[model samples]
Target: MSAKIQSSNKKGLFTKFLDVIEVVGNKLPHPVTLFAIFSLAVVIISAMAAAAGTTVDFDRVDMATGETELTTVVAISLLTAEGIRRIFSEAVTNFTGFAPLGTVLVAMLGVGVAEGTGLVQAALRKLVLATPKKLITAVVIFAGIMSNVASDAGYVVLVPLGALIFLSFGRHPLAGLAAAFAGVSGGFSANLIVGTIDPLLGGISQQAAQMYSPGYTVDPTANWYFMIVSTFVITIIGTIITEKIVEPRLGAYTGGEKASIEKVSDHETKGLKWAGISLLGLLLVMLALTLPANAVLRSDSGSLMSGSAFMAGLVPIIALFFLVPGIAYGMAAGTVKSDKDIAGFMGKAMSTMGGYLVLAFVASQFVAYFNWSNLGTILAVKGADVLQATGMTGIPMLIGFILVSGFINLFIGSASAKWAIMAPIFVPMLMRLGYSPEFTQIAYRIGDSTTNIISPLMSYFAVIIAFAQKYDKKTGIGTLISTMIPYSLVFLAAWIILFVAWFALGLPLGPGAYIRL
Candidate 1:
């Protein structure tokens, strides 16, 4: 692998720019290390700010009295003995109580089983390969978008499959890879159906919103409407980027290695059939539980989307939704022979999450410390004031926020981790600006997701580089980032446009969630 070829590809001007990003990004420390540094910095900053008598005032509605009262929040330094003791005491609780930790773990448990059964792989391959040659690109992009339903399945399964599919049809494999990567990572937040991230981020948003409005509730389906629309928007934009920009740059596929096309097996097909049936049956059962006036899943007022058992327990319900069908497919596919086999699959699934567990611990403590020290509140209030002073309001402020979030994503990879830290600040600030936490969450999601492909910090970026290495062994960080930069730029622009339009139209973000308070 030649380093020169990797850094200076024939892509010219853009490659040079992306090379800079790769170089600068590579200099940054690991995410865990960065979080540790950030935590320390927060402590020192909190101390300095506290000593300087930093404070902010915000109006909060009293739950009991039903009246608005002004409250002054003063930054508390974590440098004191009591602060240190509190930190040491709450360290374990912080990690254990992190909003996204358990939700992601439980969701991945079900996802792991499904992926372990080979059902997700088989289905994705079938979806891509079975499509007409003319629509292969569109289908690949759409499948990539839909693959978010199962965590990381799109990257591990669909991306390579897409490349192979395109290569088999005599198209550029890198273009195929780009298209699939765009859909999987860039369009991550856009899914026709609600995904694990919906609940994960929604939970974080709810926690942040509570800092201002204690009784405010954020449902998992809070961004369902916007994301559902985004599904098609991303698909179209991803297809255009792949067909117009990416493919033109690559020109033709003259790579030496023969692209190996993978096909679905008869047994895998049978497994998919049974899995689909089981999934449909599960949906029917869920519908039965929610559709009736006196149904168990309904709220006391018979509302399905608000204050309802089904809505409140969406995480567990999502877990079971994945678990049952996974078991069904596993049994049909001979993957689950006995109870031990199922247990083994579950364990294997958890084994992959070891890194996430570590990341979650450090990230949780950072968020908790920030919250306990009143830094998040004071910062948000002050930040809100600054934004207000800029005379940026409504759609423009929202657009500015999207760009800011996108910029932060270049450094931080974990969507939930970033949201965990950011939600505390941005969610409340936006709510004060007359926007809902759910609305703010969806904006963060767009920025976080759009830049995922271009960011070296993304957890799957290395995996993608390795995937690209199959065709070009010299492919390195610059090579991969350069290829993905187009998608990142285009996705950000198109998504922002969609968001602006949605905001202008005053459309509801989800079932009961609106753009503004």
Candidate 2:
């Protein structure tokens, strides 16, 4: 982006503040450096707390007999050398044992086939291209938000495609990147399609909540409606911010880089048609499986909303949902003609995972260390304890919780890990304070998502930096941080207002839910 600011463009205080953070944070240290600093700090804090015997000591439990009883104290402590050894010794076991890891990979296998067969990209391009320019922004943004249902596809496909889409229209590619990045990362929680992340985090949160309330549950899509609405809200906000704020600030396109456009390859066109058929067939099969009474796909409770078999197995279903059709489309489109061909498609999909594997490896160790140390548990329990002690109710408590979540996210970028650490203490503590698990989950999601753009520790930061390099070789962490900081601020402000207003209005956050405190 050009640094020449338009004379008509005026600076605001908040904009300047973001600019400073961008410049300062980029220069401070690499993301890995900052992450090491944080891990060290957590270790120290955990050791001190363990020494003090400050832990998640259960104050009391409301037993089945309706009596309050003091419960066993679960002390939160830091990892020991033994724990580190255990983690390293059982690295493979730990990797394989983590159900979500394999599940994510397996689910992606099918998604990769679908994407590799050129089904997903073609569909997106065709669908969005036909849309009017005014509506295109929202469509692309919404698609970017929904792409989370397929995980890394958004980063790999949508981000690049977004920049291309903007450049085709004689607009700055960075603006498109800004738009797509906002939806993909900042508005992560808000999506029309629910993905594996929902259940993974939900399960973790439920387990955490049970530390105090045995019967507590945290729904994966607890904030679905709000998020769905936020998709549109973010589209508008992102467009305005990109068009009115960042673009003008960066000035004109005098940069050395040349922007070239991509053509619709004949193969890509054929791929679209076959992929369309595959998508239709997949949809039909899903409907058939789900339509009949006592259908195999239905939940145990026989409702689509709760424990439905399909909902419960969303990860596999999502995989099959994409893979089945994609494979068929590939065969028809001549991308794949046999099982080996299919395997090749999957192999291609898996290839992209190399970088993710590296990130996940380090992230797993960090998470394991933190878990063993019990630092997260201690912080969570202590924070919840303070909240309960304050006796603050309703909006203040919820808003404050969001703030805390945002703060935690700066250090801990993994949503499930952070929630796993926080859920047990906060979920139950809030329940005791007369709140719902869903409400707490919703607040946690808002906080977790909003900071993703600004946090260097966010796993995708490296990928995003590479994305920027395509447009400007000079682009670095500081450039990315500066580019993304606007979305973080804008999204946080709008989302917080929407959530607080929702709280005041006393609306249900999701299906069969209430937001009352």
Candidate 3:
């Protein structure tokens, strides 16, 4: 009886804590408040670091180089007006030239159009509906993990879709959303399919890790084999956690106001078919451009997969794929007419992103400030020293690194940036301790992706708030945060444990690769 009482007391405290979190989250303001808070927080962190004589290595290197020469790189200071002019003149020589800006923008245009069209939502609905009931939870989670490549696609599409699918099945919608978000946001590193982020981040990781190993070659798919398996692991774990812990607490759909099923008439269905045909045609054309050895889509080289213009321009291509099909579908389906209507759709899409835009603007500045200050580097180096001193080889070091990475993620929201700060220190440290850069990278990804579900600083936090609001008007950052915290905690624990087991068994992280050096 005493033991049961103690358990009840513990449960009571946890419930009270959740309630407090919900209350605090609800009280927080929207865009302006978030902006101010995040901005001030970054400023404060920067100042404190500066005051403590902190400096970060904000150096740029050519990761493509297979050089093994070790070097120490650190950020100096931001340029003033004269320095800005000097920077502009030397742009061509700069490693991080403005070339990427154009690529990113051009790609986003295509994405904007597709997201404006109802195609993404319609397809997701059909997918969720078609999945077997038993597989629904896992499917939702898996879909979330794969959606990362699309940027905000998972937050905008899958999260809400998960809730709707659950409601349709007479389960708690929030629980379903949690399951999907956990998979998408937290297990983002564990995609069963290929994604664009692989090459981009791999490039950065390669550059950073090379500080320790001049000959280090970080494969774009270094973590792919493990991620494929982890996809299922996360899906199952997410499903079980949601159904077991989350749903029971929420009780029922008594929260009211479920989104009504769209009554797609025969005409609408035909329009969808035509839209699908148009999309297929676009894809076929894209494939043709890709399939040919000497194709226009190929980069300066004749390669079409990686080095090709088509693959390198994937983000833009994806955006275009969505825009063209969505526009065609809209016209054929009679959901759109005239240039004005199309423009309106695009305009509406942009408007919906106002909050995100605000968040991103603030986040970019914060990232810039932190990078400029070089505190991340100092912290990471010190951390590497601590890890090195432990002399824990193999799994223990990997686990410790993952935990450290998780801690770092709390401070720096951008995965690439955090990895940039981390790779130089941990990669070299692990190398000396007899661990591989690939293993360090994988462990870092696990920690980085999992905590995104709960981090308020993530650019997508506001996007998730919008998703939650669709279910309950009362849903705010606090509600979303509180709801998803369970997922973040559970996923972090379960994933770390699984990673350790994989390490213990001395399983290869990928084909022909070992976790230990």
Candidate 4:
């Protein structure tokens, strides 16, 4: 009785804490407004910094001479007459020139088609249903992780389907929901294929990196190798937590209603077969283009990974990878009757990007203002000096950064938005400490992905709670967070361990992306 009372008291306190978090999160300004405010603040700060004669000196590699040269950066006040005119003139170009804007829009166009044709959803359903009952949990979790390829489809389809699958199997429905939710939200950054996020985050990182190394480029595949490895690691860890911890805690399901698991129809199966064949053909064609010593896709030095034509054209290639398969599936499944249908599907995909486009506009201005002021460079140099002074220049510092990223995630939901605000500061600062921007990005992702499931501020958290309430009416924010906290904690630990091991072994984070400069 005493133990039960203690548990209840603890639950009550946690509930209150979450209530406070939700309240505080609600009071924050919209991300676009926040960026607008940040841009104004940057302008004002630049003036003050310039008046104070703030400057920092650092050694920069001179690309022309291939020699390290001492460089001094001084704050350029945006309040100057020239600065104000430049800002007014550059406003239109800033939005147009933002790196992430075009890349994300292009990638989503293809993803939207695949999603519109029901190919992604059918594939997810097929994977979950085809797995043997004993291995169903792992398959559901894996499917959810991969479903990120189509954005929010995993949350809308797989979360509820997981509940039905478990309930049909005489297991706890809530456990299934938790498992799928863990994979989709908590494992957001781990994927076998490059998703839209790769380009979005990479572009932001590249912009940040250029604040220090003017010509440096961070590719969309910067974190690909680490992400591929993390996919399997998260799958195995997620499966263990679901079966051993989440399921046992949920116990037997005494829910009133029983629903049948939906099986894929004959047309969907035909669509899958055609999609697979098209994808295989696409891969073979790519191999033919890339495998030869004098291949067209190779770089000037015959390298496939660096400065290659293939790397430069990767965004369109990814689009074709999805578009071709999507069209094949659509035709096979009778979802596409004409070329007009395909056009409509693509247009539909682009339509959802209205919010992102608005957010990107403000964010671009903020970044542009920061770069013009030279404040980012000064701050990075000062931050690196401070870290060097304190002797926290290695793994410990990286871990601390991950923790800070995760903590920040609780207040901001959009990954790109948080990264936009952070990349300018953290990316350059960590780069000064001898860490590559790619490595800093990987650390940030690990933190961002792990905390997503537990954050009330996550855009999809309310949606997950709604899905849960269908299974158990009493389900709320606290209930969902309680169930998901285990996955969050375990994933964070496992990823940090993986990161430490990867660091110790000196493995590359991705193609041409190393741990140090």
Per-candidate clashes come to: 0, 8, 13, 0
Q: Candidate 3 residues 1-517, lDDT tens each?
A: 9999999897677667656644554555554454456545555665565455554332223435633343454433333454346434643433332122233344455555555666556666666777898888888888888776555688877887788888888787877888878877888888865454665456555554554444455655567778888887888888887878777877877777565555455655665787789889998998888777777898667765445566555556656766787787677767777877777766765666555444444434433443444543555555656665776555666777788888666555767656644565566556655566777788888889877877666667877777667667787655676677777888888888878787778777764456865
Local accuracy by lDDT, each model: 0.86, 0.70, 0.66, 0.91
- Residue 400, candidate 1: how far off, in angstroms? 1.7
lDDT of 4 by residue, 45-112 (tens): 99999999999999885534556778899999999999999899999999999999989888887888
Per-residue lDDT of candidate 2, residues 133-197 (tens digit) = 77666776777888887776787788878877776676677777777878788878887766757
Clashes of 2: 8
Per-residue lDDT tens digits of candidate 1, residues 314-408? 88888888888888888988888897877787899899989889988888788878787888778778888888998988888888788888988
Clashing pairs in 2: 77-373, 77-374, 78-373, 79-373, 208-424, 298-309, 299-308, 299-309
Regions of candidate 4 where Cα sits further than 4 Å from its true position: 62-66
TM-score per prediction, in order, is 0.93, 0.77, 0.69, 0.98
lDDT of 1 at 477: 80
lDDT of model 1, residue 493: 89
lDDT winner between candidates 1 and 4: 4
The weakest ten consecutive residues by lDDT in model 1 span 6-15
Deviation in Å, model 2, residue 197 alpha carbon: 2.7
Measured by TM-score, the strongest candidate is: 4
Give the runs in model 3 whose Cα sits over 4 Å from its true position.
1-104, 192-227, 248-259, 265-268, 292-311, 336-389, 408-441, 455-486, 497-517
Highest lDDT against the true fold, candidate = 4
Question: Candidate 4: worst 10 consecutive residues by lDDT?
Answer: 60-69
